[model samples]
Target: MKKMNIKKILVGTAAGAVMLGSMAIPVLAAKPANDVLVKNWFVYNRSSDFAKLWDDNKATVLDNGGVGFTFNNVGATTWYTAYLKAHYNGDLTGKTITANVSVTEDNATFVTRGDGSTSTVGIVIKSAEGNWGVNDYWWPTNRQLLSALGTDVDIIASTSDSNRANWINICGLPATDATIHSGPDCVGGTYPAESPYDGFTNALKNVKEVGLSFGGSGYARGVALTGGTASFQLNSFTVAE
Candidate 1:
């Protein structure tokens, strides 16, 4: 696959939520009209050279104003990441971030390796503690999250196999007890202590950006991307106060 360079452009803030394809991002003067502040994002796949796939056509805005992307030959170790900076200048310590995410497979099938383990997807939020530096906290699948939380959640049974759109909520951030509050339809959990940004309280206070990634590691290699294709979409991303 061809490696693409991801670009970032800071635009002015508009009156309403900025869709993926509409006008450029408006400046963040004050709090947004809605409870959740949304920003334009750029999505890319991890390249062989450990780079982000920059083909603009692969990641595009849908007619409904949502963001979408197509993945091909996504290796077991391969993963996709969507980068979006926070346009809200206010403190997100007590705020909650939520999104409606969906993934569909088109002629796509995973290449089973050892144990026929499947892949999972989830979100991550990073803070700007070191002056826009990296302090990221990952929220993997529910089973994974529960396991990290010292729960008896079954990892193998935690694979997200459906193509349904589910709302995921990451709440109580910037707090020591921050948690992933997604419903049964969705699978997610808070950042584990092993994460670089495990300090959720500190990280949430200075959140600068958020990421969405797919694939699994550890027991097996990862999600193998052989021949089929997968499309991912984020219907909405909101930060509630």
Candidate 2:
């Protein structure tokens, strides 16, 4: 009887370990098999924000010809979504991001984790702290903050600027057993209870990373390139306060 009890305890412990491991794994957002997976940049996505992934990131040079990269994020990943991100770290309070760039796509897809419009394409920012900066899933109000690109001003694909008026601050997602933002298009959804406009200002003051968004509205949360090819060409990008 003693031996039997020990055996049962061991088995139960093993089973519990397996269950915990399974619960830890998250769904594939833009992950493709190694044979087809091509990533030019690396970012840490915890569990919920998988819609934002890109195959390449580039920087320009002037002295000896610039380093130019013309990429099509469409069909580049498993979900047929792709983008080019130019990373930056700084304070963007009362500032505007201007870029000389163009995104040419035969098609586009826009999806939001919650209900909001899932819109905007121009400048994507992450805070140096909070969800924008943390890598752990349990972090507070963690999410990628977007600038008012399409709704406030349609400057994408041109040499214009991305405004930060009413930028989208995603709080909850659809698959996370949370309430959606209440809109389908970018800039159309109201702010979630957890994420308010005040949070946006805090994030901007401590901006960690910023990227040039080529996919309008659904810049990073959905199948932006569902049917056709999506290409992003960047010449110059700057932030003005």
Candidate 3:
């Protein structure tokens, strides 16, 4: 219920598509602009604690692998747009985007170079200019991106081992129905019904808008690196606000 310290909402990827209309693009310089829809993104591949949280906060891993962090909000302070939001189902209106993730340590061979070695974590959101389906929220969904602000709500991490199970997600409760909160069990114990997104807790909360197309279950098993190749890479992305 309280443990959201995920460096407070993440970001990266070309200043997140272009830091919101760049200073109101000349003071509403014409009006008719409010397109912001940087959908849900919770990527955490190559989760080895991400180079000690980017060298204890030296933050700066660009070239395509986006992984920067800095904030101030409103009056002063600049540098927006984060990463990981890939999961679209089509028709992303207007356009100003960034979303893609990948991971492959020992799926068997592991040889994904370039942006191929795969291993990028995430959390990026932007959508204000042209607004076309806004509402993005996340909270510990699974294991990587662990913080967010607006839009319905999102959280994951409890696939349920029962009781004090780790975590689990799929929110948006209220109208369209969406509720899957199985766990308090970390000290307690007893809250299992096989819930990862199933066991029916409100099935995906019926997420309204955003790319839509994410796939990755929980895999636990490390320790077997002979040659090299501990994959997990999800290039940066953005569309500021």
Candidate with the greatest lDDT versus the true structure = 1
**Per-residue accuracy of model 3 over 54-117 as CA lDDT, tens digit each:** 1112222323233222221211221112222333333222223333333322222221111222
- Quick one: ranking by lDDT, best first? 1, 2, 3
Off by over 4 Å in 1: 1-39, 49-58, 74-90, 110-117, 129-135, 140-198, 218-224
RMSD of each: 14.5, 20.3, 16.6
Question: Per-candidate TM vs. native?
Answer: 0.48, 0.42, 0.23
After TM-score superposition, what is the CA distance of residue 4 in candidate 3 from its true location, in Å? 31
Candidate 3 displacement at residue 141 in angstroms: 11
- Lowest-sum lDDT 10-residue window in model 2: 6-15
On a 0 to 1 TM-score scale, where does candidate 2 land against the true structure? 0.42
Q: Stretches of candidate 3 above 4 Å error?
A: 1-98, 102-175, 178-216, 219-228, 239-241
**C-alpha RMSD between model 2 and the true structure:** 20.3
Instruction: Give the per-residue lDDT of model 1 (tens digit) for 83-114.
Output: 32333333345444444454455455653233
The lDDT for every candidate, in the order shown, is 0.38, 0.32, 0.26
